[model samples]
Target chain A: MAKMHVKMTVNGKAVEALAEPRTLLIHFLREELNLTGPHIGCDTSHCGACTVDLDGKSVKSCTLFVGQANGAEITTIEGIANADGSLHVLQEMFREHHGLQCGFCTPGMIVRARRLLAENPDPTEAEVRFGISGNLCRCTGYQNIVKAILAAAATLNAEKEAAQ
Target chain B: MIPAPFEYHRPASLAEATGLLAELGEDAHVLAGGHSLIPMMKLRLAAPEHLIDLQDIAELKGIARTDGEGGGEIVIGAMTTQHELIASDELARAVPLIREAALQIADPQVRYLGTIGGNVANGDPGNDMPGLMQCLDAAFELDGPNGRRRVAAREFYRSAYVTAREDGEILSRIRIPLPAPGHGFAYEKLKRKIGDYATAAAAVLLTVSGGRCGSASVALTNLADTPVFAADAGAALAGSDLGAAAVDAAVAAALAAIDPAADNRGPVAFKQHVAGVMLRRAIARATERATERAAEQTV
Candidate 1:
């Protein structure tokens, strides 16, 4: 197959690249775009290490081809932090609550959690559990991950209330 | 997981997509969300010579109402992602069972990349939506060189890894008729974990009147060669009160239709048992919801 041209907005930047039709979004990000925060764990969709934010939703990057994302908007974990590297609230909570171990699943975890908190600003422990259930962390058994999500929710809610 | 090399076509319109599919014949695969096809392609389990990427066709996207005057049907484009279905307020109000079923599908990331049309069009038994579609009596529209044809959900699947897809036909849209005002629907599934495929799944949508089930539709997935429509099992509720006896009869009918394989998910006996239990739970929930709708009408 011939290489296909894809134009999409990535990390708030307009990106146009030529890729093989079979090139996965994960590969396009990690190799072509050089955004390495999104890891490739299980090539089979079983592992969520290749998750990324696409058009306001978290999707498995491995499951999609680059041609599929043409004209789409995508956000990798690198984009989660502020311009000067200040952490997103979820990242701060994950660090403060010790939510990650080894961090293979962190990017996907952060990406999935970002949308979870967006949908349900204050989720219960069960909701948090359900929210990140798509992601798998081999090192941590998920106790602290749940706590970190709960803490992030509180922080976000408090910020919202204070703003009001 | 690098997939095998293949020619790609992103047709801008439905007519172009059908033309591409026709030109490529069986060598072509319509790339909806690629949640299923890309994985299998990467595994080298199935490789196609041409990939007719369907995402570019705007006509094959979005959710809208189209039953003559917008009072009878909800038409979901074949490329409507699971995430789209879950977040659709229109679907939530019209057929919450679809939203509920969409909610439980392989978690968020998969749901984001997976489409209901892909789920049913792929015809995988492990998919959570086909049984629900069957229960709802959804209609699948197909467009090819011969123009358009709509296949009933009951007759969609031909096997576990196959459907009634023609040599060059692409599933254009999925049309689900709105349920009766007093109808209720539920999907019951037993998975080992949050994102696992159901060991067995049972879906029920009941239309009852005057304290008795006027009609009911039931379907089971992953327990048969194809998504099975339990006409007799659904008939078990006909003229029967929405009580334990009705659930029991529904369970019996569902089991009678099941022909499950004994695999790692569970043994045949265990799968049957779980199927029965889940069917009852789904039926009971549907009954309650339908009853509430009836009360709301009276109010």
Candidate 2:
């Protein structure tokens, strides 16, 4: 396999990795870069377990080749913490609401949901369901996840208002 | 499931991409978002020796519309992601039907990674874009060693997973004319679950003028080897009253037009039933929206 040189900013840090031509972003992040926060549930793009923020959108990293993402800014679960190392609102919400059990799909779920809430802060229940439809949770019928997201939206909005 | 290895080329320009594709011939595939292709590649269903990545081709990456050119056509770059398509206010207002379809595609993650070009270029009967694209009467601009050419959406798909594209050709843009004022369109898809492939889907576009059906188009997905355009159903509605009786006739014809095959999803009979139900619902929803717009126009 031929090798390729890729340079990009991942999770607020500049990272460079040399990889094969067919190296998927998931494998590059996990094996090459050792950023295993992004899990790989289905490498075939069916499961959003490999979700990560690329450029400004939440995308399935498994579908992306390392070369395809050259120079693009990316965010993963590892970046969701504040400079003080506190969990992000979505992370906090998921934990408080018991949004996950078994936790295999939690990272992708929170990453995807954070972007969703960013775009639509006050989305209805239907919108929330559609927003995170890509991220599946076999455990917990998802009622609690929805509740957590709604709760996070309220907290974020209140915090913004308070700061203003 | 890891995909079979392939040589990857990230061409910066359309000319370069087309030239590389020509050099690689049938063994080459264009990588748009790869939400569709990568999965097939991993399943070992498609093993191209060369992948000409279009992500670097900046020209094919955004949605552009111009209201200044008298009446305008929405020109969506071939590699525009589903996220971009759904985000465009122009698409939402000028042709909300496309956004309606975009909203139901896969999920936020897949939509973020998938491109509209890949959705249509894959030529899968199960894909939601084809039926809607066909109903929009869209056109494709192809660039190759022979220069650029255009193909209408209706003529783009030649067979199962095959298109009219030449070995070296690359789709540059998808162009759709502004739909009629007060036009109402809806896309209805029934899927097994979130992020799962839709079992059966329908895209309906039509305009009701003064209580009469001025024009209508009904297209079905996953009911055939391609997005089947039910001509008789639209023919039965065009220029007629879009009342209960006319809708009934069109629905029946549209259902009869679909020849669904048995798959893991369900039996052919079940698919046919769902197709009819979805078609009916899409038409009804589209009509209801049309009525609301017409009422607004009078105000």
Candidate 3:
């Protein structure tokens, strides 16, 4: 098999890499782009640790091939911060709320939660639980993870209203 | 684990895709979302020499309700993702069961990447859409070297990992006739947890008129080699008030039709019981909704 030249916008940065058609998007992000925030918890799609925002929707990076994602815009955990390198609201909430213990699934959780809030800015407790059901957090027992997401949604919504 | 080496081809049109498939022959496999296929490739269960990516084919996208000779029909592109199906209000209004079932498939992330075409075409017994499509009486449109054709969803599956879709043909679109207005629908699935395949699932679409069942369709998932249509079970509820007797007969018919081989879920008898329970729940909810719809129309 021949390596294909793949180009895409990752975290608002243009990146071009040569990868085999069999190379997964998770490996491409970790190895080529050096975006290690998206951890590969389970190679299979069961664990959502490799979740990334692809074209505005959350997708498991481990299950997608690099060649198939060519020419698409992608956002991993690293892209969720502010332009001046400040923690995004979701990250801040995670720290304030103690959303993680071992921190292995933190990046994926924060990344997916940001998208969830973006899609449903005012999610209820049950809705928040269901929205992030795909992303697992074994450490916090999901109590604080859910709290952090809800807190982030409130803060983000408040900021939006204040800006107006 | 990484997948084995394979050449990737992105065809821009259906003709190009079919040409690639016909040219590559047995060594080629169509890639639609790749949620299932990629994992299989990683496990070395499927090692195709050529992988035809269908993402670039513009024609294999979108959802629209078009008028046909028989009535209204919802035509969904094969590459439409599960998320797309859930988000399409046209489809939701025409056939709400599609949304009900799509929400139960995998999870939000998987739903974003998983395509309905791949779900129905892959012949995975655990997939939710095939059984629901049978209940909706949807037709799959295929494009191959021999040109275009349609196959009824009820008759599409031959066995697990086998279907009526020909080797060189690509499922281009799924056409579902709009259910009669005031139709009731529900998809009841009993899985161990979220994102898990159903222990047993049932889809029901029914229309009630004058306190009696006018028509009904029931389909079961992961209870057999293929999605079971449960024709006898559906017949049992037709022209009845959806009474206790009618519901019991339908459940019995559904239990008899299903041939579930228990692996981790439960024993054969346990799965059969679960399947019957799912059918009864689906039928009850569907009938209730149908009766409500019938009452609303009279006003």
Candidate 4:
């Protein structure tokens, strides 16, 4: 099999590279572009550690080929910060609430949580749990993780209201 | 666990896809969502020489309502993702059962990429959509080198990872006849967790008239090599008041149709027990919803 030319927008930057058709998107991101924010925990689709926002949807990068993602726009944990270099509300909430212990699943959890919040701005505790159900966390036991998401939702909503 | 090297082709049209499939022959596999196939490729369970990706094809996306002989039918393009199915308010209003069942598959991230076509066409016994489609009496439209054809969902699956879809045929869309107004539906799945496949799941659809079942359909998932359309189970409920005895009979009939084998989920006896329980719960919920719909119509 020959290598394919793949082009995509990642983290607000256009990237072009030559990759094998069999290369997983996670590998393409981490190895080719050096964007290592998306971790590969299970290397399978079960663990959401390799999750990234592709064309506005949270997707498992491990299960997608670089060729399949051609021309798509993607976002990883590295792109979730504010333009001023401050932490995004979700990241701030996670840190304030101690959403992680080992920090292995934090990137995936926050990436997934960002999409979940964008889809539903105001989510309940149960909804937050269900929203991030795809991303597994063994260290924090998910209590603080859920709390962080809810708190982020409240903070974001308050900001919107204040702006209005 | 990287997949073996393979040539990749992205065709922009359905005709080109089928043409590539015919040209590539048995060594080629059509890529849909890649949720199921990619994992297999990574584990070396499957290694196709050519991967024809259908993502660029415009014909295999969207949801629409078309007129049929009896009533309107919902025609869903094969590329329509599970997340799209759950988000479609029109589908929810027309055939809410699809939305209900799609919500239970995998998770948000997987649903974002997992297409309805892949779920039904893959012929994986563990998939929820095949059984749900059978209960809905859906038809899958396949586009192949020989042109287009439709296969009933109930008659599609021959065995696990095998279906009526011939080689070089791409499942283009799913057609579901709209259920009667005021019908009740429920998909009761018993899985270990959110992303796990169902150990035993039941899809039930029924309509109530004058406190009795007017028509009913029941299907079971992950209990055998293929999704089981429990015709006998459905037949046992028609015209009944849906009493405890009638429900019990229906459950027994459904259990009789399944040949569950021992695996990671459980033993044969446990799977059978759970299948019966899932069917009973599904029937009760469907009955309740049907009665409610009937009441709403009367009001």
Candidate no. 4 TM-score: 0.99
When just chain B is superposed on the true chain B, each candidate scores a TM-score of: 0.95, 0.96, 0.98, 0.99
Local accuracy of candidate 2 as per-residue lDDT tens digits, B205-241: 8888787778999888888887888888888889877
Whose DockQ is greatest here? 4
Question: Model 1: per-residue lDDT, tens digit, A1-164?
Answer: 78988899999999998899989899999999899999999888878898898888888898888888888999999988977889998999999999999999999998889988888898989888888878999999999989998998999899999999
Clashes of 4: 0
lDDT of 1 at A60: 87
Q: What is the lDDT for B154 in model 2?
A: 84
How do the residues A27-88 of candidate 3 rate in per-residue lDDT, one tens digit apiece?
Answer: 99999889999999988988789999988988889999998889999999889889999999
Q: For residue B141, what is the lDDT in candidate 2? A: 89
Winning model by lDDT: 4
As a whole number from 0 to 100, the lDDT of residue B98 in candidate 4 is: 89
- Which regions of candidate 1 fall more than 4 Å away from where they truly are? B66-71
- Return the lDDT, model 3, position A23: 93
Give the TM-scores of the predictions, in the order they appear.
0.95, 0.96, 0.99, 0.99
Error of 1 at B1 (Å): 2.3
What tens digits encode model 3's per-residue C-alpha lDDT throughout B94-182? 89999999999889999888999999999999999999999999999999998899999999999999999989999999999899999
Interface RMSD for candidates 1 onward, in order? 1.2, 1.4, 0.8, 0.7
Off by more than 4 A, model 2: B66-71
lDDT of each: 0.87, 0.86, 0.92, 0.94
Model 3 quality (TM-score): 0.99
Error of 4 at B63 (Å): 0.9
Residue B223 miss distance in model 1 (angstroms): 0.7
